[model samples]
Target: MGLLAFKDAVHLVSRTGLGAEWDMIKQLEGRSQEDAVNWVLHSAASGLRPTPRMTPWLKLEPMRLNDMKTRNSAWSISQREGKLLQAWWVEQMLATHTPFIERMTLFWHNHFTSSIQKTLQPSLLYQQNLLLRRHATGNFAELLRAMARDPAMLVYLDGYQNTKSQPNENFARELLELFTIGRGQYRESDVKAAAKAFTGWGVDNNTGKFIIRPEEHASDSVTFLGKTGRFTGDDIIKILLEHPRTAERLTEKFWLEFVSNRPDPALVSVWAQQLRKSHYDIQRFMRTLLTSEPFWALQNRGTLVKSPVELVIGTLRTLPYPRESTQELLNLCRLLGQELFDPPNVKGWSGGEHWISTQTLLVRNAYLSKLSRGDLNDKSAAGVKLPNASEEQLVEWLLPVKPLQPLPTTPGARRLVRSLLLDPAFQVS
Candidate 1:
């Protein structure tokens, strides 16, 4: 059995979920590594909950010079709905017993990225998020298939514009380049063929669901990836899954997200083989990964830079804070460059070193300071007294990772906690 030491448990929880809060660590303290890994995975499977329904935006007719007011009102409502969706997911992350699901949902969000910025439809975005959560730990092939037909994706990637006459290559190119296989594995011809395959796939604006117009579909056979057939979008997805490079690409991504940003070719090949053998079963892959020796290696600890979502949600969940401050937290995340449902680009947020800069780091530190001062516009910390703890205890409680500098000899526990949070080590997972 792999040693499930206290530090190892901390590392597991940190990488698997948001960050290892003290209470959660205590729960897993003496458990075997397998038990802990199973608990996290099973908890995610069982604790899965639907995202709260988004309030639909006002339906406005086609805009004209006279309909400027209506257009403005509709735009305002869309923004509000987007903010609500972002806050709702953040709340779920805070309250979830199984945070791995949320974390994986996040990973898939970045993986199969579709932004509300371009789609301009918050309701469809929420639906897509729900789809991701439902299949977060399920089969990768199934998720890819569903995403190809997702309304938000259709809008974001211009799949709705694709037809037999004019096949838009946006979704097709991303399907191969960004989603399934890595770049340089496929040719431009493959992209064109895939676009033809997905023609006539679109969303119904009135109902916000995927629709296929048979007349618009390209019925003619199209060659793709060394195969020629009258393949529809579904067939294209199946073919992509059959490619060995798809498994390798997904394995490398998972390693980067959960293991390390830096690639280890040999280790990646081992996991890639397992992923293919399991037919892209995420639960099995996660179990193997969390319990593996390389996962617990000393050099790997605190190596990942926490994304804005992880940093915000992890801090709120760990500290004594009110649930009502979720909106402010969401706004903070937006400033930190990770507004949910509005990824910066089709490629999504480039995590790791890209998540940090001098400006963002200062903002993070300031937010931690605000939390310490009980100034987050909430009552949870108003009357509650902070424990009269020493520097070491405070550091251990707040940050599971090792600190870069000694805890300052601050007078109050809250100040010390803030300082620890601002530490360089705390910036990493």
Candidate 2:
């Protein structure tokens, strides 16, 4: 096994969680790989914080609106609540000790995607975010079960529309294609059967909880994935969990998110077997993957494009900022093509290289430049006295990995910080 050097520790921290500051990396220096991985994971688990409670706008009761004026008022309120929820999550990411918890929560969010754009209910989205955080690193099976019945998910995927007489296949199809087994692993017939199995699985609007309508449920036998029975939604989840492809797909997703964009089939196979053996224990799977030989490979270091949220939140966490700058930070993330609770589609944001575009790159550079100069509204870089440090030290402190080329000649702390932030290497994790 490769020794976990300072660089390896830095790489582990950057990839496993959101980016870490220099002090966080320094604290892990000289530690054994297993010990370091264990500490980061345990810290994240132990330091878990509860999400903020739902606000009044988010908790409004469902009501029938007969007039456009009342509906417009409700829409405006929902919009405000959505923005607040996004800012609140950004704040949590900035303050959390266990970044991996938030990072994994994000991964699961993308995996089991629910969009407020379709649901139009900020409270449902907030509730689903809490659900994702609660089971962020828990059992995959249980999480899948919870997701099947989540209020936001039901609304986003048309689960609420599914009934015995007319079953909707949106949730079931996504459950197979995007969530569990990848495309082409399951047949169209399987999707229909799974849809039938999930009939009457919906949310109770008044209570904001999952409620099964027995009268609307299809209790008739449905053959799915070669199993013929009166399978319910829970049964469908069990079958998917038992399938080998489910583990393989999840392992591939983990690799794509944390390891590399280009997955090695051999490495994925090794981890997939472990995941199956562990019965989809996410924490164990993540710990083992982080401490593995492949993860410590030098070539894999600094290879991923930082997603917008990671780029913004990671940068903010490294710098000092006014508490009131949360909205500005959220706006920056949105401008960079990532808005919390508003994934572009069912597939979610196609991260990696897709995070960068000609337009978005300019936005990223401008935001970083402003942030470095303390020009963002009500925000200033107060932490980490960069002016006192040499350029070499500044590079090390601000970036996750060493730059391939020498930094440009720059004077003043703010200028030097801007140069480092705009470095090509900083674009990647």
TM-scores vs. true structure, each candidate: 0.90, 0.91
Model 2 accuracy (lDDT, Cα): 0.79
* Residue-level lDDT tens digits of model 2 in 263-376: 889878888888988989998998878877677777776778999988888877665533338888888888898888999999999999999999999998887766665532
- At residue 345, candidate 2 shows an lDDT of 95
Worst 10 residues of 2 by lDDT: 375-384
Residue 145, model 1, lDDT: 89
Model 1 weakest lDDT span, ten residues long:
57-66
lDDT of each: 0.80, 0.79
* Model 2 TM-score, 2 decimals: 0.91
Q: What ranges in model 2 sit over 4 Å off?
A: 1-3, 44-61, 64-67, 321-324, 374-384, 387-394, 400-405, 409-415
